[model samples]
Target: MALGGCANAWAAASSASLPFDDIAGSFAKNEIVELVEEGVVNGTGNRKFEPKKNVTRAEFVAMADRLLKLAPVDADMPSFADVPAKSWYYGWIEAAVQLGIAEGKSKSSFEPSARITRQEAAVLIVRALKVDPGSDTGSGLDYKDKSQIAPWAAPYVQAAHTLGLMGGADGKFRPVDAMTREETAAVLDRILHDNVWSKAIRQTPNMGLQLGWQNGLTTAQFKEQVKNSAVNTLVPRWFFLEYGSTPVSNHADPSLSSWAKQNNKKVWAMLGNHSDSALTHQILSDGHARAAVIQKLAGYAKTYGLSGINVDFENVNPEDRLSLTAFISEFGTSLRAAGAVLSIDVSPDLGTDWTEAFDYEALGRYADYVVLMGYDEHWDGDPVAGSVSSLPWVQSALNRMLSVVPAKKTILALPFYTRDWTLQSGGASSEELTLIQQGYRIRSVAYNRSWDSDLGQYVVSYMRQGSQHKIWVEDGRSLGLKTMMAAKRGVAGYAYWYVGAETDEIWTSLSNAIRYASY
Candidate 1:
């Protein structure tokens, strides 16, 4: 019965049929033939796939190279002792290593023919697709019985299991067992099925894709878009009502307001982060109450013609995080429910210290979007050169965050401003000078790159004193790279810390690389 089923399956998979009994009667035989035909899996000497034999790492890679149709840019092999250039699989192994899809067990050994375990095969498939194992679904087969599977591979195992790719005969995932040729084929078939090869060939372009948090229209428009589109857009952070105290001058700059209106984007108001109830009262004290704060904010947004409001209330007491979350939740729900969108910008470490005073997950659910204020490694305090948010740090934050908030609702924040700290006694104090009146002849050394935590920007250092003082400013290269990274990560979109602070080159690079260049 299994033989008949195997033959039928093989026939279904290929355009040509193989001899029914030559090797077809063996379940493993058909799989080997199918894989060989697709050029994804191969056999040993004499055209024998050695069905029922153990598959090794080197042989597996050779198959994968042929299957995935990967092209090596160069033929150079860096000489691993176990995988010498003389080895037939050398070129294939070298290409896999360069692509970061495979690595040797030691500095000089690839263990090419060593039996590959089920978990190792999972890693290969996941790595080839550039899928971060950490980002996979947390559910799937339980690996409690698997002794050789490491803690780090847990996520990848779960991802594969959840997809129904590979499981054990007894309902457990045997991560350490040497994978048999039949077992390897079964897993490969599942992977090929789940991935759907046509997806790569039928890929579509996203050139006209609108992104970020705002649902350009109210009521039905937002409802329909939410149901249909795979991508969404988000608004960046802002101090909507705190700008100027006048009737409507207090909103975002007119140019920005107009840009939002024209582009179908939203705005995030920085209301209570720096505002106290006293400060909130002060806005009302001038004939406007807390209601005035919300009203003036809504009115100005409506007047300037905005699509939404983003609330940025940072450093509230830990106890206040919930209260603030509730307040913003109600505010966002009410405002956006009526049509306009509402978003919130919380601190990077929102899940930990009292400083992280907001329920981001809750806010993510309530607000139209979640603007993760992902910068601020060095606040105004640190004394060193670093990226505002390095890749590892950002990945750590996201790993913790995605647990609660959905990836679709998150928009990573990018910084446009840089800080220049003089190393003198009055160094930090010198920042008190206004952009216009700060003409104190501040000198600087040559430019050096550093990460600015507080402002969430990459800095170019210019020494102000004899090795004592320095100023860090944002450059175009950093901004350009950040934009590209955001797009690659499938985030809703990116939010610049402040559009006004952006230099011409920064804007040019961003627009060319990320924004509407054809416009």
Candidate 2:
């Protein structure tokens, strides 16, 4: 009989025959069929599913075991007084308990024969998925009997509802009511086919750009240029800290926000500290100051009709690492409640004084998107000259970053501008130049611009004022290659360091490159 039951379980999972006769033309017929095909649901006996029968705790455990492909536990039999060692559900119940997907009715009583409730099933499924529903007590549920849901199971129920695993009837979520076989099958089918995490990972590509307030571009010009580019999100420098405790607005160009809304683009208010270590440490180290900053940023997002806030606090002290993490966590909670996104920008991992303070893993967990400043391989103050962002350098940095953060939550920040270094006697002083400006300077000097395959950029060397000037150009070709690299790595998307730094021709090239790459 045990062998026969095992054979039936396998057949129910692999065979497509309609074993349940009563489910024909029922609302859950298709779901029942799929679950049977997936081996997650089996008939009670003699090829009969008993669709309307109440599912028992043991039966639900068996279904969860099959659906999750959980490994069977090989320990001594459970001490539940009612569950005998030879029971058919003994192995599955033990496995479920080991996986933390289910618990006994009491320390000594499993009550395996008792009917399972809707909320109970939800809690089991939530535990199986290993999702953190957080500590938000209020269920955003609109069900009439939501108040009756057990406090411990509220978050799980809400999570299951959000994932489309369960639903209510007649504006009521009968939390304590027994779940039927058909309902259980439907829920399992949804869990198998509709994964919420995978859906979030494959969401729309988010191409963005940071706009400096001092870029000197008018609203009309900004709109005309950005609308034609592949930018979907615009982070304009708008707010900063006042005395390290309050937020002050720079008030972006009035027309910028309206234009973004009309063009189906989102504007995120940029909150910057401009590398002020003292100010950043002050606000982050204080609990009240951190709360004030979060509140003020949320208020700004609401007042400006912005989609989110871009946190650009740089040059943070190493001691403030935990404090910064706390601020981001609290800030993220507030932004989530306000229906806004939270994106954070961090420097590259170079083991330098500036980048070592950031906690990449914590920021990845708290922020919707973690933007890596992937440029400035050789900054303006560097002693030696190198590519602004070489392909090898950026790739190495990305690999280091991915070790701590997930690719789906990471964004690569590319530079639209390059640096021109002048080799002088005392020290090398470099000037930041755009792609257009670099091209113009090269042409004016009539210097032969050659492609450096290693750097993936163009290089030009000329002698002016008795000093050798060299520049590694970031034109359309280099930008396209970097964008493709980001896409191939399966990252969220790429963003430009700032607007008004690239030529008109580069925009079309970038748009085609990103669009064709299917990012």
Candidate 3:
């Protein structure tokens, strides 16, 4: 089964077609889906939303703002050093700060990216609800972590628990630990459905597609991998077009589509631009050519019984942003009307030509999901060597994207491969390694492995050929951490860049980390 999802969600998803592929059988499944549909909250945009991934301060505040129907008492977004005005959560922060529901981490900074502790969440929830912090009964709090609760937040924690807005498990509050996205949803749902606040507060909030790419894989090979993986949506690289100036390279195969139906898998055929910026610009800039291209691709999707079209245009010119958005709008309109969906791949905003061409906000509007290629942080030619997609780097990129694209419409793409950078004079050289190769490399060498807290990844270094080799490894440990960060932020689903590159053990680790986690 694919991930559980609301029936209204289009494009792709996780178990049994849930709005989110990751939370099908979770304790908070019903509550999570309901809250997502009601726009009170959002899914992780990936398959699993788990406890290991803590909800950030901004995320908690956004939910509070919506649940409380808050308008920013202070019109200007707070001038916190880390809270940019363009950020999606700043307005929520502004409302939260103005209402005294939250405070900055320091005088100059809000540290909006930091995770919100359990006590912090309780305090904010209680304040937002305007529920009086009821008198603290000494006996009401008996958590194992009681001593860890901050003094200022103690009464609010007790009041929140008494109000049934928050609860402890296994008799431990872990007061200073971060709140998971699912926990946030449970509390928000309680406020609107399970408690008196539902009657007192009349408000509404607004808000996966788990997609895996199939690179030239025959149906047999692809089907085998599906058995061991949690990927419910199949994105096959089936077609290529040159602004429709030439015949589209038709790589369609009916057997794959047939198998998809039998196995309840979704096939989103890709239409790539050959990584030609000029070719992409030609069609995007020309109305006639653009319309013709969309008609052909949408027709192909309907003809092939596919779920949707995945647009993988790369190396686009910055000046073509408007044209790109226009093409997406026109293409998406036709697809939706034909009972199909649209998803677009985008690079992180690095103020470069490769990314400047993408208008994430605009594309997100037209397409059902904007798939962020969440890797290449340290690309092939970069002078420095690092994990391709470090946890912190991915976190920053996700925050930037969510500031524009709605969490529900955003999909984070995970990399199944890592780079082995070989240090050389003046600069460095690197070679791509599959999950299997990287695993073998780590085990084969007499290297020193240590955890990098900042990257949330393991760093393995060794000396050979008179040069020190530093490998920011991407193994089960790193992948799990990245997924946790995604779940923490609350996205729609996740997409592995391509299948067939992972080690055998990778799937088991992925299942444990991204699949069966309880919030």
Top-TM-score candidate index: 3
lDDT of 2 by residue, 1-519 (tens): 999999988766654457675676457888888878767788877667888899999999889777765433322323366777678887677666543467778766889999999999998888877677776553598999999999988998998888788999999989999999999988877776766533532354344343332245666766766765667787777788768224454666656777788878888778888778888888888898888888888887776778888888887888888998898889989998888989888888888777767889999999888888889889978988878898778888888888999998888988878988898888787999876677677767845455566877667788888888888877666776677677777888777767777766566445434443441
lDDT of all predictions, in order shown?
Answer: 0.54, 0.76, 0.76
- Report the lDDT tens digits of candidate 3 across residue range 149-181: 777788899998888888899998878888887
Write down the lDDT that model 2 would get. 0.76
* Cα lDDT tens digits for candidate 1, 134-163: 754444445557545666676777666666
As a TM-score, model 2 comes out at 0.58
Q: Which residue window of length 10 is worst by lDDT in model 1?
A: 432-441
TM-score of 1: 0.45
Clashes of each: 26, 1, 24
Q: After superposition, how far is residue 511 of candidate 2 from its true place, in Å?
A: 2.5
Which regions of candidate 2 are displaced past 4 Å? 1-214, 250-254, 425-427, 515-519
